[model samples]
Target: MEDSNGSGRGPTVQDVAARAGVSISAVSRAFTPGASISKKTKERVFDAANALGYTPNLVARSLATHRSGIVGLVMGDIRNPYYPEVVDALSRRLATHGFRTMLTTVWGDITVDDVAPSLVQSRVDGAIIASIADADRLGELLYKNGAAVMLFNRSAATSDKLSSVRCENVEGGRSVANYLLDKGFSRLAYIAGVEHIYTTQEREAGFVGRLMERGVQLFAREHGDYTYKGGFDAALRLATADTRPEAIFCANDITAIGAIDGVRAAGLRVPEDISIVGFDDIELASWPPYGLTTVRQDKAALIESCVDVLVEQIRSGQRTRHIQLVPVSIVERTSVR
Candidate 1:
């Protein structure tokens, strides 16, 4: 047997075959999904591959089978508690189905055109993008390029011209608005997250629409970059207004937490002087400090559905081009009456 590059060159498939005393085709069959290889040979190949650090080349497999077992997760910042939970749920679910997750945070710096090349290089079998409807063309190109694509939380135009998984943003907005009104908050303000994102826009529209139904109006509105500090600074502005709002609604939990700081530092009591509400009942929302009354997006179900749809697309080579809207609910807590 010829030893090639003991000086830092990693073991290859050939090395694994030689170590296991098997033909090259037998080693390939052992690793390749659905390929016919005897159990004993499979075990031997696996043992050799493990010993030699000979991980299967996913790209090479894609070239042969035309199916990559990798999924690309294109999303925004993972700093938000909601996304990390979604990612964790999706990653585990995908793993159970023999798919791996590759994460990418656009961070609003790169364009849609820049996304596909990286995903293509990684040879992701599918992609799940959490973004607004502005990237319809980009999404279309991805689907056209052979990767299954799904949009989470945010809606995107599909190959079928409908959204995939459209959450009840409007309903959530009404729920928050009614909760505040029921608690008798007359003066109101909204701390929005990342002006262009779909969630913020939807929640704002829904909340404002419902508030108008009660003949109430938003006294002020400020932008937060879906961040804690963004909410903190925006909260200060709202609280210090000439006729400050008696109630403030943030788009997400992080902003709500920051708003809490903003409200307290201004010498106002929570639920007494100023009531607050938020969306996405993240883990932090239930903490003793926040106890935030917010909308629940059913993170587990959403992630499961996302993975389910993508896996089916990959397996069948067909699009499950359907928009699934999971329901949202309002959870009452100390922040609201």
Candidate 2:
């Protein structure tokens, strides 16, 4: 195969073996981590490899072992700050366990089922998806293809057939409602992420449901499309409306920042003119400019649970059907009254 430098080819394992005065199997053992090779032989193999620019072909090794040592990570909404953390943690943790991550982007219009056919050919031991348009159909497809799968940050409604790791979004939202109401926020508004997003739906239900029990109606609602600019525009419209909301609950931290900016642009003081609360306590939420009050989803717990589920399914060659929920807590800052 032609290399990036447009060379015909590069050094092979056999060349290293010959230069090191060792057999091919010896060279292989030296390269394999935790393989039973003498220190001297390993040093010799490395010296020869460095001199000849020979690197082991992982694809060929996987072919011989019947294990790809790779995991597919499919996700959308790359713009969200939360997702980049997810990707980085998964890649780092998986590497320590000797697995590589193959990231695949799924468009909003595409479902997991549409991508399954291609995944089957890639021969990945397992996959972890951040979201799915049709969970029930994709669950069946993965089962049929004999691939173990885990869903993250969302759960399937069709059945409890899929494994998942997510935060307690509903309870988190309810807690926000309780906190805001206790602080005497009578005219509350909601800044939604997306109409159909599972987390947003669950959170909205919890927040609105709590208000209903208190005999207080929601003052306003706006859809932010789970984006910063969406929140900015939505906040502007809400601020200019006839009945301005006293408090606003944002779906995520980025949106909250945008809303804060919007409120400022409209010459409104935070917590004085309009108190704001947001979910997902991203790094920027605590910045001096925003200092957003938010609910914190435990990123460390979520990432660990996902890795555990995927690894168990891959190593056991069986589905555990485990569902893990990481708890969320409110982090109070200056954004709220």
* Angstrom error at residue 208, model 1: 1.3
Instruction: Return the lDDT, model 2, position 112.
Output: 66
Which regions of candidate 2 are displaced past 4 Å?
A: 1-54, 108-114
Error of 2 at 43 (Å): 9.8
Q: Which ten residues in a row have the lowest lDDT in candidate 1?
A: 157-166
Q: What is the Å distance of residue 107 in model 1 from its true position?
A: 2.1
Candidate 2 global lDDT:
0.83
lDDT of candidate 1 over 239-282, digit per residue (tens): 88888888888998889988888888888777777888888888
lDDT of each residue in 1-337, candidate 2, tens digit only: 6742345678778778888999999998876543678889989999999987787888888688666777888877778887888899998988766678888776677666567777777777777878546655665566567767788888877766678889999998899999999998899999998776788899999899999988889899999987899888888888888889989999888888899998888888887889899998888899998999999999899989888778878777788688888999999999997
By TM-score, the best candidate is 2
